[model samples]
Target: MIEGGALVKNGHIQQQLNQQVPDASDWLALSLLPRLGAGRLKQWHHERRAWPQQWLEALSVPQRHYFLYLRHPQGHGQVLQPMLDWCTAESSRALLHPDHPAWPALLNELPDPPLVLWAWGNLACLEQPAIAIVGSRHPSSAGRHHAQAFARALAEAGSCIVSGMALGIDAQAHEGALSAEGATIAVVGSGLDHTYPRQHRSLQQRILNAGGLLLSEHPPATEARPAFFPRRNRIITGLSRGVLVVEAALRSGSLISARLALEQNRDVFALPGALEASLSAGCHALIRQGATLVTTPTDIIEELGGPWRASSIQGAENRPACREGGERQRAGHDPQAQRWLVLLRDGAVSLDELVLRSGCSVSDTLNALLALELAGQVVMCGNGWTLSAPSSESGAQTR
Candidate 1:
C-alpha cells in the first residue's frame, strides 16, 4: 500500500496506473513528432480511431520516411517512455485525453485544444464552474489585493479560481481560493516536475493538498521558456467561464489571456485602477475595448452568471462544519496554538508563516499544529492550517 492507504501496485487500480488507455501510447508518440500539432492530431483522432502507426501507410513517401525515422530507439526512449512513466503516478497525477471523462469540455471551444493534458492533484475540480483571475507579474499592491479579494469571494461562492500560478496577481489569486477552501487550478507553462518560478514550490504543493489542480499542456520534465508561457495563458482562459484582469501592462501576458477569453466567447472583466498607475494601463485599454469594468466580485459573478455572491463569509468561515464545531468552543487556547491559529483566522497559513509570525521554532510549531489537529481545532488545508468549521454553523451560507 502507498502512504495514503492506496493500493497502487495491484488489482484494477494498479492496472489502470500502469497502462495508458487504448491508442494513448500512439497519441503520446505522435505528439513528439515534428509538424504534427494539436489541430492536426485532433483531425487524425476524429478521422481515424487508431494509432499513428496505422496512418504511416497512407502518408506521402517523405512523411512516411520521417515517421519511420522517429521510431528509432533514441526517439522512443526520449519521448514515449518518459510520458508512459508519467501516466503511472496514479492518484497524484493523470494524462487526460479528449475521451477521458475527467477532461474539461470547455477546452473543446479552443481552436487548437491540446491533444493531451498533464494534470496533477484533484481532477474533479475540472467539473466545477471556474473563473480566471490573471494579471501582471509585478502588479501594484492594490492590484494584488483586488485579485485576492475577488478570488476569495468568488471561490467561497462556489466558483473554481483559475490562474497561471505566476508570481504577482496569479499567486495571490490562487492563495485566495485556497484560503477560502475552494478549488483552484494552476495552468503552468512548465512540466509539473519542473515548476517555474521555483519560489512557488511550496505554493504548488499547497494547491494540490487543498484539493486544487495543476494543469499543463507540456509533457513531464519539459523546461519552461518564453514561448510556453503564452500558450499556457490560453489554457488559463479556456478553462474558465470568465477572465478577470486585476492589473496588467499594455503589453503584458495577462492581456493575452483576456484576448483568448474574448475569442472563446467567455466574459472578460477588468478592474479599473488609478490612471497614473502603469500597472493599470492594460486594464484601462481592456475596458475601452468593452471588457466589463469590475468593482467587486459580484460584478464578475453577475456578468458570468456564476454562483458567487457578495455577502458570503469565505476563507475559514466556509470550512465544512463538524459535530464539535461552533463559535462557543474557542480554539487556540494555548499560547503556541494561539499564535498559529490567529494567522489562519483570516485565511490559510503555511508552516513557514506560522514560524515567522509566532517567532517559534519550527519543531515546536509543528508539534503544536499536530496537537491542534488532534483536538480538531485546526485542519491541514493544502500546505497550510485553517480553523475547522464549528457544529453550530453547520449550514454554511455559500453558493
Candidate 2:
C-alpha cells in the first residue's frame, strides 16, 4: 500500500512540474528582498533578460547579500529547496513576472507597476473596461445614494465598477453594480485570507460568486494598515479608465485616489455638491481644479464615448436636489448652523475662511457645518462649502 501511494504522489508531482509555466520564482523571490522595490526590480529584470549571469554579477554587495539570502538561506540548500517546493506546489495559483500573458496591460502604463500581482478569480476581468468609484468611509445619505445609483447605471451600460470595498460609498457602489448583475472589482488593502471591515464578508463572497474579482497586491495573511491603503489606491486608479469621486472631505483618502488617477492620465469626474458641507468639499475642490463635473452616469458615458445602453432616467430624477436659501433663512431653525452655511455661500471657501466669515468660533462653525450637512442643507465641494439645491417649496419660500 505504501508503494502504491508513493507512486500516485510521485505522478501528481511529475504532472505539476510538467504543466508548470516558466516559474518567475527567481524574479518573485527577488521581490521578497527588503531592499528591492518595483522600480529597482524592473531595472534588474530588464538587464537580466539578456546575459542573466552578468545581471546577478552587477549588483552591489548589499544587493547581492539580499539576493543570496533569498536564494540559499544560511547556506542551507535544503532551506531554499522548501521555498522552491512551496512555489511549485502553489504554482497554479500564482502569477509570475510581467512577461506572462496573463499580466495586465494597464499596469505597464503606470510609472510604477507591481513587479508581480498576486491574483485569484477570473484573470480575464483585468482586460475589461473599468471605472473606479471612491469616496468617504462615512458618507452622507445623499452621497451613498448617489454612488449606488451611478454604479448601477454604469454597470448596466457594461462598464465594470472598481472600488476599495470600504464602508459607505465603496460598499454601496459594489452593491449597486452587483444588483444590476454587472461586473465589479474590489481592490482590497487586506489579504484574501480575511475581509478588513468584517461586515463586508458576505459582500466579498457575493463579489466572487458573481463573476467579479477580488484583488490584492499584498500576499495572503497580510494585515491591514494605514500605509497599505494609500498604496492600494494607486492600483484602484491604475485599473480603471477613469475615477468618480462621490463624497470626500479635503483630506479623505478618496482624494488621494483622484490625484493618483490624474497622474496616471485617467479621467477624474467629481459629483457637484453643496459648498457648505465638509463631506463634499474634496470632490468640489477637484471639480474646481478641472476634474470633470458629473451629475449623472450618462455624463460620464458621454465623456468616455463608449457603447453603453442607457438605463431609465428615473434614477437620476430621483436624486435629491441641492438645498437652497441664504445661510440666514435656512439657519433660522438651527441658528448656529445657519451662521456657517452663510459663510459657505460665497463660493468654495476653506474651513479657515468659514471661521473668519461666520464670526463663530472654530469649533462652533465646524459643529454647525456637520449639522447642516446632515440636514442636507449644505454639501462640501473640494476644500470649501456651497448651498444645496432647494426643494420647490423651499425655492418658493425663498422667492
Tell me the spans in candidate 2 whose CA falls farther than 4 Å from its real position. 1-22, 43-48, 72-93, 307-399
TM-score of 1: 0.70
Query: Which pairs of residues clash in candidate 1, taking residues 3 or more apart in a chain or in different chains?
Result: 210-382, 325-390, 325-391, 326-390
For TM-score, the strongest prediction is 1
Cα displacement (angstroms), candidate 1, residue 368, comes to 25
Position 163, candidate 2: lDDT: 96
Model 1 weakest 10-residue run by lDDT? 1-10
Q: What is the lDDT of residue 191 in candidate 2?
A: 67
Error of 2 at 178 (Å): 0.9
In model 1, what lDDT does residue 120 have? 90
Go through the candidates in order and give each one's C-alpha lDDT: 0.72, 0.69
lDDT of 2 by residue, 1-399 (tens): 112121122343234224223245455555565656677556655555442344445555566555544444343244335434433454334443677787767766777777666665556667778999999999975677678777876887788899999999999899878867788989899766669889999998898778788787766667898898999999899999999999999998999999999999999999988779898799989988999998767788888875553443223222222233533223335445444545555556766777676666543454355445445566656556676775223433543
Give the residue spans of candidate 1 off by over 4 A. Answer: 1-22, 46-78, 306-399
